[model samples]
Target: MTDSYRRQIDKLHDDVRRGRLSRRDFMIRSAAIVGAGALPVLPFGARAEEPASGGFMKLGLHNASQNDSLDPGTWSTSWTGASFNGGVFNNLVEILPDGSVAGDLAESWELDSGAKIWRFKLRPGVVFHNGKSLVAEDVRQSLLHHMKPDSTSGARAIVQQIETINADGPETVVITLTEGNADLAYLLSDYHLSIYPALDGGGIDMESGVGTGAFLLESFEPGIATRLKRNPNYHKNGKPYLDEVEFINIPDATARLNALLTGEVDFIQDLDIRNVSLVERSGDFAIVRTPSLRHFTFDMDTRVAPFDNPDVRLALKYALDRQDVIDKVFLGEGAIGNDNPVASIQKYHRDLPAREFSIAKAKDHLAKAGVDTLQIDLSVAENAFAGAIEAATLYQEHAAQAGININVVREAADGYWENVWRKKPFCAVDYFGRATVDWLFATSYVTGAPWNSGWSNAEFDALHKAARAETDEEKRGADYGKMQEILRDDGNVITVAFVSWRDAVSDRVGFGEVGGLMPLDNMRLCERWWLKS
Candidate 1:
């Protein structure tokens, strides 16, 4: 084979290893390059495992809050996502295990020539738990719920781009966008855009929690536990192998680990990296580490004093020893972040220069900011992530070397997302990461977005708008690359590391390839995983 052909094969292999491309896709592309007769033997576990049916599965998850709601727009934590959104409801599109978008509720979709209009054909014969047939109207109204002016949905910025949503008969829905967005389908796969039955009065009935998903909600108690049972009439054939699934909220890492150890739960997400060796030695459990776009951050409100100064923000970024945190807290299982949310595996990821840890540079930036010494309060909770408290303490020590006093405030985990994050000027936060760069930016960085940090720049906003509308691949990539640089240099959020999604599953459970976009197999464990018969 030619050297170029060999390089192409190598690239495909790398993509498969990183979970960015599916094994099936790799085989197809590789066979085309080398004739079918030259194909190599299939590796072990290459074939899909047949899913066994009928058993109970329970998951111990963290970050569940009392403020959790059945309303898709209000759902945030993994507790609600894994129990309700992933099992009890379905989005128009779904991100597959290989990080590709596939039809979920929508059987197929067509984009107009200008890329400004999209038409989705609903999957027929699909019915919600209440026996209501899935229709185009349900999709329109479900999305409209987040587009309302008064809506507080986290997906508001994403849906606001829709100029109109019209139902064409019972099965087809047309969406007109104010501007072209090539990533619209991926954005629709967002958990907050789950389809719900529409009310006769022109709004979606989100409070009911009824959806055309694989499982039905049996009982729910916010911040506590959610119980669900298999949907007898689920559209996905042979799915929801578990007879019942339970998602229990366990904020304490030690308690969650103990529950998994004692067989009280079949699986647990956000596995404490420190305990990986213990689980491995036990032989009763297996670790699923999927590299993801998930990043931990220390957000500073630019509207607040001291942080308002660009030099002060720069100083803080320089003071953070990202490698140290990744080594000590994450057990060196993650990649050091460049203050950018985009992961190296994703499209349009720019390989920006790594920001080195230099106390001298941090002190210099503080001097430039007209401050001899700096002091800041960093609010944190375990709910932010598995080792957020320890990460904060390490940050405090690192900052002290640069003449910065960081007061670490340990807050209660019950209402951390509601009470502390985005409310405090400086605090620790974590994002499960979105499927696309545009979706990630629209959700957390856009001006007027609900989850936006206090920093805003007209230039960055313009680039974002331009990039979203640009259909040219080369130009679009350049625009996105510029945006990453902008965030890295001037943004208020300090991204510490892009960590992998680590979860522990019982040996009794069986599954196929796992998704890396979010924890618990992209929060679809209940439907995709099954017990060993």
Candidate 2:
């Protein structure tokens, strides 16, 4: 890692050590910047594009896949991320707007002296959409199910440190970890922790959306649309006031924008950068732009040639113009990345100087690594992003000067993740963050990790495990910082940019708030948001 980059990580470590960047600060900034504008219970005042007579809100989603699993633990992509937030489930601890821990199903919690053991006391009289009361046993069962093998839920790695999770009583749940978890509170606040009721047969159903969340599932058609209705028996009174909510899947970005413009749908997930100003000028819609944990980059398979050598990988990093990609493609919608996996969510975030972009540098490395005529297969999902086509075009233009022949291969939108990305030579992908260092490390970089990009480092894995085992906040931060250094130096991954999360809403829509860090984490809140009548 560069000395400059190292200093930034050290500075972040110092901030954490000095207590300047507390969880509360992170949450409040996230809430105001991310969760603001869409007032939950407050009125939206008056707007030009008024809603129809009765309270009805229609949400249009663009470029999100269908989530078949209601179990939050199994969520993988943005598709599942959206569904998890759509009232299919609830978690014991809720992460409020300000990054502080809040009570959701569990009203109160206490940590043991060393912070290794945590106890949660649930609130009584909370009922699931199915009219079943949420009890302590349900939390235990839901968490245990996630830890079991064959559970693809994202929380398996994060919760693996827990030695036991059992109900202390009807309203109390206890969690005994093998050691101290610095971010235990944040982990529980994750969207994946949304709990489910105990299943009748054997295990939790993978296809059903059953939970103790605010809204009840009214109708669902995979890859099409999901409709939810207010849960009258919800624990929070006067909530979910809106009679009903509908989430429509419009995968085409242009089509989705059109739907929102024509008043066919009240909201859309992401907006094209070029259209932001256009939408703002219309005065019919409101744009919610917030910095997010989302990171996008390209991966080179170490198992493949050209990228097999570290020098070759580093050369490719120097060859492509990241700023140009962001400027021309993202249209200045994001911050430049330093080819590091750790994103803004980490307390260790640092601003690194841009890597010099030169075609000569790319040619030198390719020549040193081998003969000539470098051929690489570039795989991209058809519906991956708004500017994917444009970005690929630019990459082709710049990389051609380096004598690199990129065979641009596009995958079918339907089965791209299953059939192509996992086993591709070169591909572009993005990942959102988990609150804790261990959670992100375990899922993204650990040995045998599903997202490792076929690159393995023993020292990197060791540092991550050591960080997870350490209880002291300072020591844990130091350990994770070391892992980031290893990743930065090795050039195993290229973090293109920390893209801002974008959403567009009509002025007529009364309650459409977007969370900063993980907006998809709370989709059910839409049920309570209504159009200004």
Candidate 3:
């Protein structure tokens, strides 16, 4: 029986090497193998799960750029984060299926009775990629470096309430909070919390790649490809079996789809809706749909003319048909969204006024405001998403009917992030993450938030700050509810639609499981996947 199974596996790889087996053919053979073997090769059932093995996996990313820094505290772009995930990083906590935190770098952690202090017991014997032993002092130094306001780490904004982080012993770390923070666990689980080695030159840097993660950076070429090799000193047992991973940046969506279909890449993520059916219908490919926590919205400059008028903002909100946008643009792959930060997973998500689609109401507001021909500059990036350009075009057509003219200015990939997205008067951009209410509210909705949609209320700001300090679930929820109410009823922006991310994998890869919103380090388990024989 063993000999027969081995022969089948060998034959599969032989076909792959000879280029005689397309992904579709490989999948067909895989299905036969599954049925022919009465005793399963894997104890795990039919569901595709991550595989553990030694093989090279080629991954396709939307675009690659000069993101050399793998120090998670500072990296922000999705491509950079994905590159870090290959096995070179580990955070204190990891997200579980039920939305609770599980130990990753830290063996155990607990909050004080007052919720003002947190203690973490570190796992011993974990070694960095360079073979250095990981200790509690390394964790403290990395976190404290971010705590300094001058450090300017994005994580500083999220961990604002943390008063101090100290090494209690060689294997213990303690953190003091200026306020009772309930979402500390969530923040720790954030990818940005992935630890860095103890500093030597006044700070820690990953230029040489010295993390306790599963993969080590072997070579990198900005905007072209990044190559990573398995870490031999990895702490996790029986993990990181993949010999190598190469991420090739294919900016064009059509090109990316073509590459995946041609078996040039093993996995492709962020598949747009237009090509989803094409990939799905191809029998050789296995489509995995993960619930997306990412959402894109337009931010208005309320501090400037036109948008400064609450009536103008309210009228614009009524003009947008969220349902129509979702159906026509997203093609039934999205959910309706309001101008609120709280998503469905959030415990405090409250039902506010659903955006009513009424051109008449929009016209009335325009007339009351005495706007005849309204011209607004709308900025968007061509590289961000698949249908963003078309979505903006559709909105322009719809808004024109209501007597609003949008001067659409498209930006290039290289300049959009700095010159257009945030700096532009009216811009469409995506905010991706499973954020706690405080983090999301403070980042985009609060008075001085970097992405604040040109509207600010002192009361809202106070409540946002207090919510982080509350620590009590009920009270925190109430604070977030108030924040949501202010944004929904009186905010300056329109909530568009929540998008779903699609990943298409070839069936030759063996894994019976998929992923949820809570992204794992090896998001799709490339380490656990094996080429079918």
Ordered from best to worst TM-score, the candidate numbers read 1, 3, 2
Each candidate structure's TM-score, on Cα atoms with residue i matched to residue i, is 0.92, 0.84, 0.85
- The residue-by-residue lDDT of candidate 2 on 500-525, one tens digit each, is 56778887775433344565433344
What local lDDT score does residue 442 receive in model 1, on the 0 to 100 scale? 88
Please give, for residues 1-533, the per-residue lDDT of candidate 3 as tens digits: 86786688657644432223432354567668867765244321134454557778888876455544665655555666666743567777766533456788899988885778999999889888777888888888777766665654557666666888888888999989887776777777666667888877556765777777778888778767878888877767877667888888887777888898888998877776788778768889866554445666777888888988777777777777777777888776666778765665455777677878777877888888888658898777656455677778777877787888877777776545445655777887766645467777766677756456568888889998887777577987888888888887678667676654466778876654333443322242544455554
Error of 3 at 269 (Å): 1.6
How many clashes does the backbone of model 3 have?
Answer: 15
lDDT of 1 by residue, 1-533 (tens): 56667677777765554345544576678877666335353321222457899999999988788888888887777777778889999998888877789999889999995778999998889998999898888888888889888988888988888999999999999999998887889888888888889999788886777888888888889889989999999888889899999889998888989999999999888888878889979788987666667889999998899999999999999999998998899876777787998887778889899999989999999999999898889999988877889999999999999999999999999999989988999999888888888888888887877788678988889999998888788998999999999999999889998876778888898887777787667778799999988
TM-score of 2: 0.84
Against the reference, the lDDT scores of all candidates come to 0.85, 0.67, 0.69
In model 3, what is the error at residue 503, expressed in angstroms?
1.4
Pairs with backbone N, CA or C atoms under 3 Å apart (clashes), candidate 1: none
Off by over 4 Å in 3: 1-50, 71-74, 367-370, 450-455, 518-533
Comparing candidate 1 with candidate 2, which one achieves the higher TM-score? 1
Stretches of candidate 1 exceeding 4 Å from the true structure: 1-48
